[model samples]
Target: MPRRSYDHYCAASRALDVIGDRWSLLVVRELLSGPRRYSDLFADLPGISTDVLATRLKDLERDGILTRHRIGPRATSAYELTVDGAALRPVLDALSAWGTPALGERRPTDAVRAHWLALPLGRAIGEQIDKGTVTVRIGETVFHVVVDGAEITHQDGPAPGPAIDLVLDLATANAVANGTLALADAGPDAQWSS
Candidate 1:
């Protein structure tokens, strides 16, 4: 692929030049948490073909959005967002907020991932506290989110030591994301330990 372009002299066009491909932003979304093995990205990204995923990774690396590096003796490779890529947080936030209204009710065929709620939920949690680790559990999936100053990051599983713990389901998570519900008022089923 020669790489597609809008061929216009606009800032949006310039942005599209870097991330206009089908799975580009979603690839960025998966990487927002931290570095991920290619297999991890493939697994989280449900419907993407192997070829397309490989191509998106190459394109993002070529555009300086992310970098792939090998670690340890086994040389396990992982893809991580560059500074410029991590800066896409606000863009992703805006996009997530914009799309939240349309996420009304999960259909029978919908596939859900707990960490998919990381960005919006992280933002929500960030607003509630200045700095702290929050462990979020949605069913069996567990992840810990760290909020340090203005930055928020999350990873798979729980945060070590004493931290605030939150448990909620997909419906409530959506409500929080959509601003229809407050975290403090997550009802009897939702529990939090500080």
Candidate 2:
């Protein structure tokens, strides 16, 4: 199907012409962590239908926001952000900041994923530390975030080498993510161990 457009000449409209679809940005969000297999994306996105996921992936690829490549010993195909897609980090950050207040309460129907906290929490951590890895444990979920200068990246498991281990409950984690509480100001709520 031909993609739709706003038919406007403005730059913002032009950008939106490529990404205004419902699931496009969310797909970009998932890929920001790194490459992911189709099954991984499907599993992480709770409510997306397989058909919709496939369509969004194709659309993103067609628009140059992402690319599909082979990786690992089995040469599994994975989707990863292109430079253009990674550029969406600030956009996501802006949205996260703007939407934080809307996240006042977690509805029972809201789907929760620990890795979803990586972006905001990583942003907060990046502000306080210049370099090093921090392994964050929230409940049973474990993920490690690497802060390098102004860039932050994360993966779904613990860091391979030595890292600062920090643990938080969901409430504290949410506060960190929403900017209500800085990671540094998390105080006693943040349990840190070398």
What's the TM-score of every candidate structure? 0.88, 0.87
Local accuracy of candidate 2 as per-residue lDDT tens digits, 49-110: 99999999999999999999998899888999999998998898778767877887778899
- Per-residue lDDT of 36-129 in model 1, one digit per residue for the tens? 9999999999999999999999999999999999987999999999999998987887898788778777778877787888878888899889
lDDT of 2 at 73: 100
List the global CA lDDT of all models. 0.88, 0.88
Worst 10 residues of 1 by lDDT: 170-179
